[model samples]
Target chain A: MNDTPHIQLKGVKKRFGSKLVLDGVDLTIRRGESVVIIGGSGTGKSVTLKCVLGILRADEGSIHVAGEDVTRASGSKRDAYLRKFGMLFQGGALFDSLSIWENVAFGLIQGRGLPRKQARETAIEKLAMVGLSADIANLSPAELSGGMQKRVGLARAIAANPEILFFDEPTTGLDPIMADVINKLIASTVRDLGVTAVSITHDMVSARRISSRIAMLYKGRIIWDGPTDSIDNSGNPYVDQFIRGSAEGPIRMEVRS
Target chain B: MSANENILSSNWNIFAAIGRVVLAFLAGTGRLAVFAGIAISHIVRPPIYWQLVLHQMLRIGYFSLPVVGLTAFFTGAVLCLQIYIGGNRYGAEAFVPQIVVLGITRELGPVIAGLMMAGRVSAAIAAEIGTMRVTEQIDALTTLATNPFKYLVVPRIVAAVVTLPILVAVADSIGVFGGYIVGTRSLGFNGAVYINNTMNFVTAGDVRSGLIKASVFGFIIALMGCYSGFHSKGGAQGVGAATTQAVVSASILILAANYLMTSFFFSE
Candidate 1:
């Protein structure tokens, strides 16, 4: 894997009407590095990821994916750029109408236009990588448990063996054991595939386990960025309050009745 | 303190609110237009998902047939009975076959089937996608380099457009048969005469027009469901609202479009 940054964002800003979701965000992900973004709920962690993916166009600034300017790339060019990244959604986002193997092979069959039989075989292979049995490939996503669904989602994300992987709260709804398992799987998969990974999570343990570097997002800006081992002693107040899960901190939840 | 003045003021306020709502709706519709254009562009490009399209065709089109069929059958029967009663008083009982054929083939079958599908398919699409949106599945698709429009919306629209016409065709045939069954069995008409008269009075134009309407209605239903669900906000409440809006909007559009198409096809 190359040592240069695979994904880079500079001065990216996104606003929804009067409320700014991502305000002048800047970040960089080195090739084959796992960077987990940590933030409170509604702190623009997801927005940051979206900006990078070009799902939500930045109001201002630049996004470079694999050294190509993506902020302004539209249509096929953006789509071509997108093929290099894999994302695991928070809820797995499996098509309920499709079986497990079909869901896993969605990118392979639909996005890549592979033959059904070949796609099914590839889907089963990916599923096996996520520790799922081939027997479960015929089942609908609705038939699976939450953890299984996440595994299927993981299988789907890596099906294409993308250069960059994005995980949006992958461990959110899973049990502690499942979350840890996912974290380990993510860690090992990143290592094995040598793919650049970016994840956003409120779970500090997950962030620590899956990430080589951690970034704390606050007020739509990344307040601190450092290696996983240096997070505890980052000496940044916002990072300190967030990692400790303190109610009294620079971050306050918005409450309305 | 006058009643007329109070009523006038209330009406004025209502109109003003309605004006504001109309403007907002137009603005939102404009945004949807742009989104739809983006979605369409994705449809023609590479990375087409034929399997997803087939899957959606089965889900949105094939699964919806029974309800559309049942609704059309009942509607045709009732229309025939009402026409029979009215024609009997006027000594115009011979008109029963003609009116029933026209009613089912030109208006009833497509509109009724479309409305039923709007209720069933639109709500299903909205609820499924809205839930996914609230839970961040859509976002996940984005990260996976999967265009949600291509992966989610395009297949649905295509399936609906393709399947709705077939369903409407089946419903139209079944509905006319229903009127025939009722006209002959209950209204004491000669079975052969009813069938022959129905056939002779009904032109290919009527059936074709109904199927055309069905195609348009299908697109409208799927589009509304997808648009509402894709843009759904809030959480559970937002998703619920999206589902309700999708069904209601699709149904109303089907009716409105039916009237417009009817006038266009048959107006003097």
Candidate 2:
């Protein structure tokens, strides 16, 4: 095993104006490991991921990816760092104006300067891997169903064979069967590609199925971190309260914001 | 908690509120200026997406022909009719053709076309980009190693800068033809004499200045649209606000810029 973790965050703190979203977040993921951060709504899981991606800067703390300090990097250095990451946004976030194939081929053609024709071919192949046919390639993303859009998003994320993949609530806004299919696809994709993944989700079933390890976030801190199998017996009230989906537990819902 | 103290604090709060509003407005202006600077800097760089620029040109310029042409024609006809009626009182009715050509070529053509496009193109841009922002497509582009400014803003800016002048030229030709129609038919002037009067009286400088105004107006329209859209937050309401801001600001800036350019070009 490598001495240094593939992705590391130490005391990552971020605040938007008066509200502190991420307060002293610390975590590490080994190479080829899948870590899913589980939390309730507005728990700052997305903020942590965005901080690592350099989309949002942490007010305090250091984020290192592949031994490079991503927080301070700028310009082409930052762009080079970003090239290693592939993200599946919660909503798929596919460009509505572009055809499905063009969305998948976007990174290759734009970032890698690949020829459009070659990129399109590669995109079709990726779509096939995600169980989509080439016939739907020319259709705009708006024409597809939510589940299909998610599949296209997955295809796009893995199209470039990136080193690190970030899935932001991959199963969000989907039915149970479709969500399971997506989870299986994600698990297989990550396993086959052997890429490091950090996902944020509230879906416990998804966390258990897609990740080797689970970290539960509460009040802007990681309350517990351990292997997925050990999660059931972790003996943490918050984790138990969250996993069981119980209303009467140590975790109290603040109804009035 | 005393009544006098409460009144004093309320007055102080009002002053603070005013100060905050002014400060926020200034800060927004400063941020927009910086954004404009960065966008202009990228204009000279490689990886210029000519295909996207061409598509935007077709969207912003080619599709705008009918509306711009119609507006210019009507405006020119009205200006000729009004000048003929008004100039008759001063026994200078023959000046209609010259002034109508000058008005269409120099001022009314560019300004009207600018305001029209500001309403049409700017709002659409702001709405589209705003929706993209809210949906995280902009962030998705970033993760793919694509700079949103280079991919989105640059192409639109280039297209506007290139196409607005062309649109203005089209409007100018149509506007002159409109004036010619009114002059020969309604005013009973000889068609050949009207054409000769227009050709001989309007200088090349007038057309050049109008085109210059159109280009600057183009830059303003696209810049506002992209700026508002990029900064948009929340959801559909934010997109709506961005669209309104884009059109309103672009129109105001176009008129203001026209004033500056007009004074610079035609001032004594």
Which candidate's TM-score is highest? 2
RMSD of each: 3.6, 1.7
Tens digits of per-residue lDDT for model 1, B11-128? 9999999999999999987977887787677767756667778998898778887888788888888989999889889999889989988998888889889989999999999998
The candidate maximizing lDDT is: 2
- TM-scores for chain A over all candidates: 0.97, 0.98
For all predicted structures, in order, the TM-scores are 0.89, 0.96
Which parts of model 2 are misplaced by more than 4 Å? B1-7
Per-residue CA lDDT of model 2 for A139-207, tens digit only, reads: 999999999999999999999989999999999999999999999999999998999998999999899
In lDDT terms, how accurate is model 1? 0.87
DockQ of 1: 0.53
Which one wins on DockQ?
2
User: What's model 2's overall lDDT?
Assistant: 0.93
Q: Give one digit per residue, the lDDT tens place, for model 2 in B41-84.
A: 88888778899999999999999999999999999899999999
